[model samples]
Structures are given as structure tokens and as C-alpha cells.
Target: MFGESSGRWLDSELWHACAGSMVQMPPLNSKVLYFPQGHAEHAHGGKVDFTTRIPSFIPCWLSGLKYMADSDTDEVFVKLSLTPLTQENTNALLMDLEDGGDDCGNNNGGVVEGGNQEKPASFAKTLTQSDANNGGGFSVPRYCAETIFPRLDYSADPPVQNIVAKDVHGNCWKFRHIYRGTPRRHLLTTGWSNFVSQKKLVAGDSIVFLRAKDGDLCVGIRRAKKVAVGGGEVSVSSVVEAVSCGVNGRPFEVVYYPRGSSPEFCVKASVVRDAMKVRWCSGMRFKMPFETEDSSRISWFMGTISSVQLLDPIHWPNSPWRLLQVVWDEPELLQHVKCKT
Candidate 1:
């Protein structure tokens, strides 16, 4: 009688085990595409119409993951995804989408060859004493100045320009940029102190700047990582790293992935708080993108929360970054595994 059995139950068990294995596998650092409005066919079509398009998908790097506690269960049920590139940094990206056009006017009143485009530069620099003190200037690296800033008019004295910088909140800050001193360097004077004060930036935090396609400057902040000394609980800090200018020039925090092998993505404090406010329960369906071997491709997986794990006594009881075990469907993966979402 055992031999005559169809063995359907055994097959089901094996299938679930395989799905669980896939979910338990650690994710790697790779590029993935994010479609804000689910998936659309026109996204893959050539000559995408930006006008009628609600919002196009963006490609970004996946940095890491952090677990958060479920408010209902008071256990970790959600994982916070992290990435360095956020929508705030999309100005440069959007410009690239515009067929290599340089709207930033040059001295010749003409677009420079290759659209005067330079690869976006990113680096970490500690705030100096002058930057931390009341001094109204922030020193910029010479390489950053030359690459990220508009081409300077050396003929003009001081080589100064009034720049309108957009913050993570899409707030426009008018600042003065001048190339001055004996050897000649780049500095953000006048409004520098105000920005520092408003953002509560200190001597240790790092600043990130990017030049958009329209020659407008954008800025982001990166706080130094904190150690959990003797604690295993994962805590989400309210740190703002990068800012992206959304539709109608609304500035919002750009998710920042720090420079390291971490799986944590730096998101706005408000985002974390908002997510935690939602009640997540076991058996609830969860969907998120997963990277394929190509890195350029992205696939979505749907899973149900199997169990919520509470933090150890040594861990922070209130921390949101906790652990959740999930079980995914198999046949769905076979059908949609290669499709972009």
C-alpha cells in the first residue's frame, strides 16, 4: 500500500523545504531595479514616454538588510532594506536619461562636447574644526570641486557663484561657492554654517555632494556608525544620509548604503518610525525584490511570515531590527522568477 501511494504529501514537504532554503540564503551586493508603480509593459519598451509615464523604475545597488520588530507581536517581523542610491540622487540619473543633454550653460553658451558630463563622484570626509566651529566655510576636496562643480571661470576674480542646493527634504538652500586662497580651493561659505546648524551636523559626520544634470548641487549626510556594546538587539537610528528631489522638486531622504560590507540601508528616521507603526502579523503576505545572477535584473518573491523571533535579553527590547522567518510559494516563483517587477 505504501508503494502504491502517489507520494503527493512528500512532494509538498520537499517543495516547502526548497522555498525556505531560498529565503534563508543570504543576499549579495548587487544592482536591482525598483518599479515604483508595480510592473508595467512600457518600462521595457524603447523610447519610453516620460510625459505620460507616472513614474519609471530606477536601478540601484542593494547594500544590506536590517530587521525590525512587529509592533503587534513585539517581535521582529519586518526587514528594512538599504541602498546607497536613492531617488534624491536621481537628478543626475534623470539627466542621463535625457539623451546626454547638458542644460548647464557653459562660457561659450553652447553644450560642451559629451554634454560636459563627468562621472558622479562620492567620498567621505570628516568635518574639520573650522567646519565644526562657527566658521562659515566648509572646505571641499579639489578633485570633487573640479569634477562635480560647474566649470569655473578662472578669468573672474574669486571664481564665485551663487548655488541653489537641494537637501533631502527638497528644500532649496542658497549658498555661495568660491574658489579662493593662495593655492585656490573650493569652499561653501556664507550659508555653510546655517546648514550645519540646521542639520545638527557635527565634526565627525560625513557630507556627500553630487552635481545634477542642470548644474544644481545636491547634498547628503552620513553619520558615523554606532556600536551596540554588549547588546545583540538591532536598533534603527534616525539618521538622514542622502536626499532625492522627487516630482515637483520635493526633497526626500535618499536611502544611503554606507561604504562597507554591511547589509543595512540608511533610511530616514521617519520611514522607520512609520513602518513600525503598522501592525504586522504572522501569515501576512510579504513581497520584495530579489537580485538575480545578472545583478541588472530583479525578481519579486512573495512569502508568508512563518514565525517572529524575539530579541535576546542582551538585545534591545524596543529595537525594530529583529528577525522574522518566512515561507514562500514555489509555483509562483517558477512563473514569475524571471519577470521584472
Candidate 2:
């Protein structure tokens, strides 16, 4: 039966050429042959099964020729074929339409390394405001809270394990545990489980921990289901915030980077040259081989600013992006949790 009850003939070339392969144009340079014989007895729904294959393609080709072709074929196969009359003619007419619409965006639709159009801006702004409005009040730097609680080593630790945490929006983040070797740092890392519980992370979520220059720890989330790179699983190698054991207990800071934020702010070469002198809580920052890709917009805490601000509109100004401040209780208590020297 090949998983189709409508009696509509399956088109393997139409689906494989468009949905199965990541290459958009299907490498027209090489010949492609799709045979109906492949699905004649496919009991598990075959290559032509609409249910399984359609959803898989949706995430892969979010916006490309494959996406376009799928949409067109779906319309004809699912709708026009049921028409009162001239169904064949209508289907033929639609197939004649050539593909277009690649000019308006990038390979991943609207994503371009450092580009933040609207979502990240809104998330950042919302977080900042909520944190400010909390009952215990927003989180301040460790230096500012010293009077309320005693300070710990706040040094960097080699990542013990890699974990993934995701937010409600379905974003994926790869996190590395840098608080290894001692019970104190373990407690601190364990405390992060609260975020996981509150956010309801399943087995596939991503959670990242970052240490900044002043010993402040930042938390980020990415849903597990959305992560597809490197076997679609979490690993310690993806950690960008690696620190030396000798640097442990010396103070560090945490910076939160949202998705789609922009490259101009993230990859400022001049700033990396003078990183030691910078002092800020969370804002535009860099990670990794800073010069490799020009499109990564970085977010972290640095400089003298107390809050994250919209770094002016470049790619999408009208729907401008901003940072979100998180509201948390007992910032002083969390700061008191000491780490071994």
C-alpha cells in the first residue's frame, strides 16, 4: 500500500530530489534516478510515505528549492486531485511553475551568523525587565553583593560533563560543565538542575554554562530536539568557554548569547585584543576562533554597563532586537556557594 490511501500515484523523484537530499539543486551536474520499483513493497511506508518524510524535510529545507517543490507537490497531490473536474489539467498547470524566492534570505532562511531580526531582541528585553522587576531584585555582580555574602574562589574548572538544556521556544544550546574536581563546584553545577526542572528539560535539551572575566556564571538553553550537528547529541568538545585550572578561583564572569544576534557586535576584532581590561555584566562578546566567520553576533557581559542594550539596528531595525533580563531570587545565596581553590 505504500502508506497512501488516496490512490494517488507516488512520485519518488519529486520527493527525493526535493526532500531527501540537502543539496537544493540536486546536483544537476550528476544524474539522479528515482525508481518506483523501490517502493513497490515498502511495508514500513517506503520512501514515498508522506507522513514520515514530509516532517523530516520541513526542518531540513526550511526554505529552499526542496521546500518549494514539496509545497507545490503537496498541494497538487492532496488538494487538486480531489477537484470536481479538470483535476489533471490543474495539476499539470501547477507543475509548470518554476521555482523562485531564494533572493530574499540566506541558506537557513533568515539566519546569517550575527543577524538578529526580532526574536532575540524581544527575548533579551523581556528577560532584563523581568529581572529588574523581581521581588529579591535583579542579579548584580559578585563584587556588588560582597557585603551580603562571602566570596568563593570563582576559578575556572575543566568541563566534567556536557549537558543540553532547552527553553520553551525550542532553541538548542550545547553546555559544558566547568566546575569539576571538588564538591563545592559540584553543588553549584547541581543547583542548575533547578532551571532544568523549571524549564521541563527532556532527555534532548541543551544547557550551557559560561565563565566571564569577573567570575560571574551565565546560563543558556537550547532544546534537544533542535540540535542536529555532530551526531545530534551533546558533547564536551563543543565548549567555547574553555579555561585553565590555574585560572580557577581567580574571578570569572558569565555571558548569555541569544540566537540570531548579529556578527558586527560579536566579532569586533579590536575588542578581543583588549579583553583583560573590559568590565561588564553581560553584553556583546566573542568566543572561539574569532576571525573565522564574519557573521556571528556575540552576546556576553563586558564593560561598565549594568544592563544589556539594543546595539543599534542594522539587519532588521524596524523590528529591532533587544536583550532580556532574567528574574531570579536569592542572588546572594547562590554567590555564597564556594568553590575549592
Q: Candidate 2 — what's its lDDT?
A: 0.24
Best by TM-score: 1
Name the regions of candidate 2 deviating beyond 4 angstroms: 1-191, 202-205, 209-341
RMSD of each: 23.6, 24.3
Error of 1 at 103 (Å): 41
Model 2 CA RMSD to the hidden true structure, in angstroms:
24.3
Looking at model 1, residue 58 earns an lDDT score of: 39
Positional deviation of 336 in candidate 1, in angstroms?
A: 44
Q: List, residue by residue over 1-341, the lDDT tens digit for candidate 1.
A: 01112111211111211121122211234333333222221122212223332333334433443322222111111232334345554555444434433331112343322234543343335577787666669897876677766677878986988777664434678778899997888998989888888766777655656665455566654443321220112212211111122223332222211221223332222233345445677888877666442222357777897866643323224333444667877646744533311
**What digit string (tens of lDDT, one per residue) describes model 2 on residues 1-341?**
01233223322232221111111222211111111121111112212222111110000111111111111112111111001113352233223212221231122443332234221111111123323222222222322223211233345344344444332222334433333343423222433445544554444333323332233333333332322221111122111111111012121111111121111111111122233234435543323221101111332222223464433333223211233233324434323311100
**Model 1, CA-based lDDT:** 0.43
Lowest summed-lDDT stretch of 10 residues in model 1? 1-10
